[model samples]
Target chain A: MKPQRCVAEGLFEWPSDEPTVSGSRCDSCSFVTFPTQDACPRCGADATTPTQLARTGTLWTWTRQRFQPKNPPYIGTEPANEFQPYGVGFIELPEGRIEARIAGDIDQELRIGMPMELTVVPFATDADGTEVLTYAFRPIEG
Target chain B: MDDVAIIGVGLHPFGRFPGTSAIEMGAKAARLALTDAGITWKDVQFAFAGSYEVDNPDAVVNFLGLTGLPFTDVYNGCATAASALSQAANTIKLGEYDIGMAIGMDKHLPGAFAADPVQYGVPSWYGETGLFLTPKFFAMKIQRYMYDFDITPPTLARVAAKNYRNGARNPNAFRRQELSEEAILQSPMVNDPLTQYMFCSPNEGAAAVVLCRAEIAHQFTAAPIYLKASVVRTRRLGAFEVHSPWVPPERADSPTVDASRAAYEIAGLGPEDVDVVQLQDTDAGAEVIHMAENGFCKDGEQEALLSARGTEIGGSLPINTDGGLISNGEPIGASGLRQIHELVLQLRRAAGDRQVPGTPRVGYSQLYGAPGTAGVAIVST
Candidate 1:
């Protein structure tokens, strides 16, 4: 089974460039939070105008889910037959923090404050094979 | 020492009462407090009520009518009641009022957790995907912490086991069935690394306290406890976007540390002086770190504390003598005040079955909201 889709469905896809992950910039404090907001939680500033996110950022921290998630979360009518553990991490952007799912197994030597780049990958595929894409981070192989 | 006396304390038992509302719970707690104080409702010079959900306007008006008292409402997520405590203390200390009352109450049901969306801007992926639920989000933290600290599943399960064992003896607790560490570990994992038993029960309950001038407390009751220290802090005002490393130096006298320090300074005591404590254990992992952050132990030593049984009723700290949220259940706003209520009982040596040995002189309670919001206080008998 695929992962469960989000309730608030929007046309979210990253454009390849400096601002990789799309998000709104808080006009008041200049703080950036993902999944967009009307006002900046930081300075209580208005973020009416959302700017694209910086694609390239550093990995502040990361963790992986060793098991399946609950309903309204896990994809399909039934649980996945095989659990494929996935890595998730905090990508440090200039505006704020953005967490992304990871693609491909990387070396285990990952450490805090490592440089990373944002990329788009399949978040989950629906029953009809409709692929939903979401942002992901990978080490910027030196 | 300035004698801080609670002339009144009130409570609505922890349980599932679906028909009850947070507003009703708050009012109930306040009404009971008025009676407990042995003073007319009109005697309360100021009032502060703790609530998380803003849906109930009646809660405010009803309490106002019940006592004809003019007061403010405080909301700090799970720390609502504790925040109210600090607010009332500040008001009383300013000589604005001779008597103050604080109440906490919530009526929440079991369901997938969701919070008010980030209305100010586009929500984070967490908000959009609904990954921001407290249990789910904290599960992520627990998973990370386990790996970093090399903590085993049984070690975490021991916390729930200990709380349940004591909770069974408290008539007011939600889940009083004593559970073993194996049972908690075997329960279905809500999120990886966190089991259903490890999560706080969705409960409906209320708790209240009445504060009077320190010097006059003995007149109300021979065993009036004194408030030693109170502190409340919010995430650095404009640091929401700042992550762990980029955050500013915590405010001088920040709410979390500052409140406890003030408590110790005012009481002329330290963490070492505390005989009993009630920590804000909204989540199992939170209890671990909060105990360390609150100076119960050094950072990363909480797992050891659990292993050594140092947090048990007769252990070195005797923290959370009331079974904590994990067993007593969390009614959001009421949780903070409930901790204080627990401390009061322990300090007075009135706790029946789960009482910590000795007449506790100084007791502490610390509550937290999300990552950065926290409140702490120390009380003495």
Candidate 2:
């Protein structure tokens, strides 16, 4: 396998198998937040602890992005001619809802409340030739 | 607390002005406002300038011949002007200053606002993954809203058409041409349900307002619009907004709701008292959602409101009488002040063609923006 690195450190586990997004759960309030929070946003307590978020969830909402985003930060390697529209939305995980780029054929029909599973995807390649990976959600297969 | 009154309002029309620097536009608006209030720049005791693209809105004071007055620069996303206005009003209300000025100006490139995810507490990886879609954020919000409320595409189209029609009557609006509902629907799709014309572009403009304690109002203008309330609030946890990668299942009151509720509480007036209204129409869908958030109507009632022409001028509840950001193009920092300028014009019976009839007594304006910030202002004749 090609050498790969996660887009942002500590956002999600790498290794390309058994992927899980990281989050923070408040011990006092039972509130959860993605990418981890030092302090609970709900109760303002410092009891937030690291937790792996659910890998599957329901599609709460979605929309197709038709325009090419202004890049500097959007380091996707897709050429302008080969660029295709994509879906983006919030997936309602058991821990909490998280926004993600929807992977797979976006032209296919999508509906709210469909089951979705998290998957690691290629974001870009760094100067060191390391594949930068980011997490996305796709409709779970039967 | 002293009652604050807006004695003068001015605008450097909402449109692109390539050669005009933000400072020059801001100075022009300041001069117009000072002239309208029959006061020299020297008489202004305090100033609050709001801007995003403009490096230093306070620098405009040099062009206006500064009188060693206290000037503060503020930036609260798209609610920049509202925050400035709120601060200016509070300065007068607290009896710290008898007369003050609030101005917002910006010169932006033609596109969606260039925002960094890191600036809003999002990880850089969020943007790297191509999840930094502002229009899609709006579309997703309205999509869920539509799913919950059963609102149709035609209703959204009608909202844009109403604003466009109203924009045609306002000489200062950026897009003064009226668009039909059919035309709006047929416009190229931007995000799924939103069309190209349904979203406002980031453009250039400046607006200013001269405010004074109600006791000293007659010294400025014969018609002073009383600032009943001005409030600014940010999103709490679980409130869905632009740039947030995740939201808790439990929803919190949006910033608009929090700000609007506080504004009405302080003003001792409800939505029923508002004769004219201005809402943040960053997109057509935003206007519909905001209508409910601002307490004008309940959720799921937008379709009926749009179909009945209730939000049009001369209707029961005229909204965005000056065409909103949808028609005016959002100049970020100056957008909220532009709404205040319109309300002032309407209250004084100076809004010639786009005037709301029946001696409008009260007006309300709400502006919601990126990274979760909202501002609400209630004014009365």
Candidate 3:
């Protein structure tokens, strides 16, 4: 089996237990963004540096995607018959908040303000059979 | 500066018309608007057409005539008509033209609106992970709103039911049949907190209006609804909107707030003075949230307001009197103009069955859409 890798290059990496999504933090406004963009969203300053986001955050808002999304954009490899509904939410990190898929808990168990930690999950397989991993937030066990 | 007024308005019924192309529908609407204004196409000085699927909306003029008038195409997501109207009004207000036209038409496949993430300035993986869905954006926003405002799910049901009921009465409406509140609540859940019936599908339609200097409006029609104001505003930083990858913790008001405030100031009127309104009901929650954002009500008042049928045609301040997007089936560009068409009909007392009870002197319409943009228009006797 080939080794697993992050879905997008430089989005996030799980080298060890400490996992975080990589993004840019603006020096002018201290604003943070995921998938690492060039300019600050708040201040439009290009002076920014790459930084890993918070490892844990609270659920800001969430919803269960009860239906399968249209394709071309939705690249999940789940079979049509076996597709599972999932939770999607904005995780409130100290730097700001980032949208991510919610995992490890049933849809009903997800709630606003719940503690969550970053983790990696299988999204799809690459052409070379490499497992494509994406970052998701699972509920933190109390 | 010349004050603008809508001399005439028309609509190509907002349901599915399989054989009709979007441009054909647009041409039909333009011709209807011309006839309604008691003028001919040759009389149009300039025109603006709005559409999503039709890249060259300027081509619509080919069907109308080859009079060689300067034509412009506009595409502003759901606020396309409002943008078109604002530009057309401003053109006349600028003393450039006395008679101009604003029109919108669209034929969308039946489903939730889908788009490439790159088109909206987001990463491809955002959609690949299925987080780019439009309905989820509404659901999450409303879930948080309801939680903070102490609103129950039943309030959503009431909003849907009221709009559907109003749609049922409007012949041009796409969904011309009333839906029970119980059935709406029991429909299949597409996203958390929003059922299938709670959302409006993108469908086909066209709407158009002819504008002239307010002084000359009476030459075309005896009952001219003066275009008191038209304004469009983009979302400020921290405002939550569709296709957002992230939102700031310190939230800002949606663009509708600014547009609404500017519109009221320009019109020199307040919500209380407005006799009728048409707001975006992309989903039930949108209408509810807009009521507060537009200053029609305060936070957490929708539950009581909707229960009393406050937004009904016979109520204090009717909203979505033409069934809104919930009944009209959003045709992107045409949706805003459809609101104007309904308002014109109501203000003129020509809306046979769906007219508001009183002689509504003031009518308002607001359109909000993707990338966080808002357009507002106010018309009155």
Candidate 4:
């Protein structure tokens, strides 16, 4: 098996059995944000603490990306002709609402208020054969 | 501060011009506005140029015969024209210049605007994972709005159909052909809720407006449209907007809401005082949402208002009389100015086939940009 690397360095924990996204919580306002803000976006308070985000959430809203995005940034391992559409939306977790790629079968029906769980997914393989991984939300199974 | 009025307005048809460059298109609009204002370019004191794809908008002064006037280039994503217009109006209001011009021009590649997230302060990983899709953001916003407001797909289709119908009447519109609601609904889906026909394409075009103090306005035209208010705002924390990777669960007012509120306050008028409006319709869903954001209607009332034909040219409130961005493909920098051009024409009763009945006295225009910027302006005859 090949070793995988997180798509973004400090975005989420990787190379472990369980992965969680890193976030920032304001000490003064109790406001939480994703991707770790240096200063609190809400109250502009600098006293913040690094916190791990909730793994499960509810689907707030969603849409199917029926077309291939422009390249340069949307680099995929597959050829352009083989590009497949996917789901994307904001998931309402206890801490905050975060936009994420919804990982699953593209044809799967998505409904608002449905339970979703965050997990690591393969995005693409770089030229060096390192598997690029990103976080995505999937429907939580019973 | 002295009041400012738009002495002249011009638009070089909003569509693809294969053989033309952005500079040529912009120059044409500038010359037309100068001619309409009955003044030469030499008489212009200061100028502000807005553009996205164009390398040098200030270079347009060369085509108009440079008189060593101060020309500044500005870019504010989709709100480019709003920023230009606001600054131009301010120059005249502060008694700095008697006559000034605001112009915007752009030639864009076809399809969805390919915006660089990193340039906009967004992380590269967001774009790499396909989470940076602009259309998807619109779709999700509309989708959530629908869930909250009980808006249906048919209601969204109706908005597109109305804009297309209006576009068919405007000669300057890019997609001038009228599309039936069925046709719009049946169009290929770009995002889950928004179809291809509902989305505006990025194309080439230019628009310009010449402004002068209201007290000296009669020197140019008999009926000068007054610039009552011009305001621009950006989104605050917790506001849902394009390119936001995360949002606090507690909602905040969008830029559209704040800009429109300030514009109305400055103009000393509410939505009822306006006879015509030009809200940003980057997509069909956007128009529906902006109508409420601009305080034209209560939230979730778009379905009834749209069904009642309230937004039609002959309806109680006419919106996008010149077909809007849906009809005139978005030229980024040029889009907001194009809205002003249409409003000016409506106030002057110069809108031939698309003129709203019962002499319109007040006109309003608003444009929302990527990430979080918004601009709003109110004009009166």
Candidate 5:
């Protein structure tokens, strides 16, 4: 049987005050995927090992919505079931992969490729007052 | 690439079919394609189906009991149908099978037409998926393009006006009605600068095509339209990951441009060679942007090119002759083939009220999906 890797356990190890990220190193193609997995998304290689990804990445593309999104992504209130603009785009990691998210500034001048860094931020709070934090990439200057 | 011909094309009218499941709608299209090809279910060699929300595998399995043919399912967001056609064409090109079928169908209740953030996941601190809506996401790209090119809402309205006029002739279209510039311009704002009419409504439908090796195309139909080429690509370059300078040298070719270029290369043709082009019209500006990006015009020239009568029905290169997603409605999985089916119909001289004048010797269809996946195919009479 293949060894099991529980995400919950991994999340615990990467908890705040001790930040960590996930990735996979493919033995066959040497391809790596962040938010690590047992197989490579590039070459379909199952020969993979879990590894930690860099805490920082480059901002690939970004846009802010002037409206709100349906189902509310992280923790913003639904804008009356109507449009509430927001921003989102890809963030390229040092490993050459990307992730999407809700953007901060709407009018910030964004280019195609730019240097950025990752930070753990709060998404939304549950009824229990448990503030959930998620990852977001921002301009390094921020 | 081996020669391949489209023996038949079929579609369930594009509109809101909240009453129908994607599988049911897909089956209807598959059955029609089967009949149109003059082939019974038993003669099929292989099949491919596409959908955004349906189970990836069951999309193929559910059809087995209907068409009784072996098949596989594909899911690639909005380009689902086009991807299915590409797979089927590739299978035929490889000589693995002389005949193959591809179908795409979608209903929006489950995943709708936007990319799923849960699938992409939030890193924990970064929350709120408000920017993920289809309109908002595309608006970002459109806004950037508009800012770079000095585009106005009226310029975008021109595309909507054209598509609505074209859709007026499409009996199966959803907003088959007409819209004036003022009406389109005044519609509620889905995305700022992108009015209500500029956006495609949630549509549900399906489309299917029967493909065969070129040499044997005559067996299915004496006048089968040949699928001259197919191209697919993803924008893993500077377009998505980081904010690179929009400078030409630094900015790589967009996925749509790259896919169309590859397709034209494969077909040994250029945009000028294409008599009719059916491109994705999920958003009004999409048609204009694709027209230029697909080589119908130079970059940032779609506004002027289209305004100067370059893309009308009787103009040099008529596009989206069957109304477009704006008029016909964006039917997700069915949209890609719907574009191809329109091109095929035009090539076959079967587009009645919406027909382009003269014999359309060559045609092209394209689809844009999932922020970066672009698929294209060239068809010839």
Candidate 6:
């Protein structure tokens, strides 16, 4: 088995079992942001607190990416020829709505307000044989 | 600020101009506008040029002789033209420059705009994960609107067909062929609710307008159109916008909403006064959403207004009389000016085959850009 790591540092917590994202809460304005910020974007307050985000939430809105995005910016695991459509959505956590890539079948039914849970998945393989991981949301099974 | 008047307008046909460089296109439009205004390039007091890809659109001065004037380059994403025109108008109202020019041009390659997240102050990971694309935001926006407003998929198709119908009549439009609702609906689905046909292509074009103090506009042209308002606004904190990693649950007015509200206030008019309208139809859903955002109708009222053919060229309130971004395609910098061009022609009763029936007294144009910037302009004959 290859060693694994998160795609970006300090984005979320991953035990390879239960994954939860981190966010920043402004002590000045009580504004919250995902992936955690050092300062508040709303009130420009330097005093911020790192808060753990809920792993479960409801779908706010969603769409599919049918075309291959431009390369330099898009470092998706799939090549143009092997590009698979993926679901993109915003999930409504208790604190804030976070934009995220959705995991599972593209053809799967994804309705707004449906239950969803956070998960970590393979993003890309490095030349050093390390597996890069990213966070995603999956529709919780009934 | 005093009211400004558009004395002359010109456009470089929007499409694939293989040999013409963007600077050349911009120069052509500027020269034509100068010719139409009966003024030489030397007569212009100041000029503002808009472009996205072009490093310095102000470089158009090299093509048009260097008169040693204050020329500015503007790049506000899709709302570039609006900023150019607004600055020109404000300059005139300041009593500094009586006559000035606002010109915009861009030659973009085929497909969507490739934007770096860092440029917009968004995280690089947003672009890396492929969620930063503009089309997705439009699709998801209209999709959620459809869900909340009871808009059907066919209604979106109808909006595209209407633009195509208008485009087919306009000789200057890029996609001049009229598509049926069935054809538009059946087109390849790029984003869930928006199909390939529903989205506007990023193409090449140029447009220019010569503006002066409204009091002296009659000296240049017989039918001068008064610029009632020209304004631009950015996103509020709680609004949903492109290139965002997350959004606040609280809803806030979009830039279009803010700009349009300010424009109406400045113009002392409302949607009812607008006889012809040109909106940012980057996609068919955009037109629908803008119909509400610009205060033409309420949020869900489009579901009813569209069904009754209220937005057709001959409808009570004609929209996109010369086709919209859907037909002309989007040349980032030049797009908003194209809307102004259409409004000038319609207000002057000069639009040939696509003219709205009866004399139009007021015309409205709006432009919405990435990272949440919006521009709005109102004109009257």
Q: How do all models score by TM-score?
A: 0.79, 0.97, 0.97, 0.97, 0.77, 0.98
Candidate 2 is graded, for docking, as: medium
**Cα miss at B255, model 3 (Å)?**
0.7
> Weakest 10 consecutive residues, lDDT, candidate 5 chain B?
B241-250
Q: Best to worst by TM-score, what's the order? A: 6, 4, 3, 2, 1, 5
In candidate 4, position B308 carries an lDDT of 89
Residues A8-112, candidate 5, lDDT per residue (tens digit)? 235323345646556667989777665556766567768898776666655544555544444444355434564444445556555654554434565565665
Could you give candidate 4's per-residue lDDT for residues B153-193 as a string of tens digits? 98888888889999999999999999999999999998989
Q: What's the interface RMS deviation of candidate 1?
A: 5.6
Predicted chain B of candidate 4, TM-score versus the true chain B: 0.99
Best candidate according to lDDT: 4
| Residue pairs in collision within model 2 | none
lDDT of 3 by residue, B210-281 (tens): 999888887888888899999999988888888888876677889999999999999999998999999999
Off by over 4 Å in 4: A27-30, A45-47
DockQ for every prediction shown: 0.18, 0.74, 0.75, 0.78, 0.15, 0.74
Instruction: Give the TM-score, chain B only, in order for the candidates.
Output: 0.89, 0.98, 0.98, 0.99, 0.91, 0.98
Cα lDDT tens digits, model 2, A46-74, are 98889999999999999988877767567
Give the Cα lDDT of each candidate: 0.69, 0.90, 0.88, 0.91, 0.71, 0.90
Report backbone clashes per prediction: 24, 0, 0, 0, 35, 0
Candidate 5 local lDDT, residue A8: 27
lDDT of 5 by residue, B174-270 (tens): 7877888899999877655678788777668888888988998887797989888888887753453112111111246778888998999999999
Per-residue lDDT value at B260 in model 5: 91
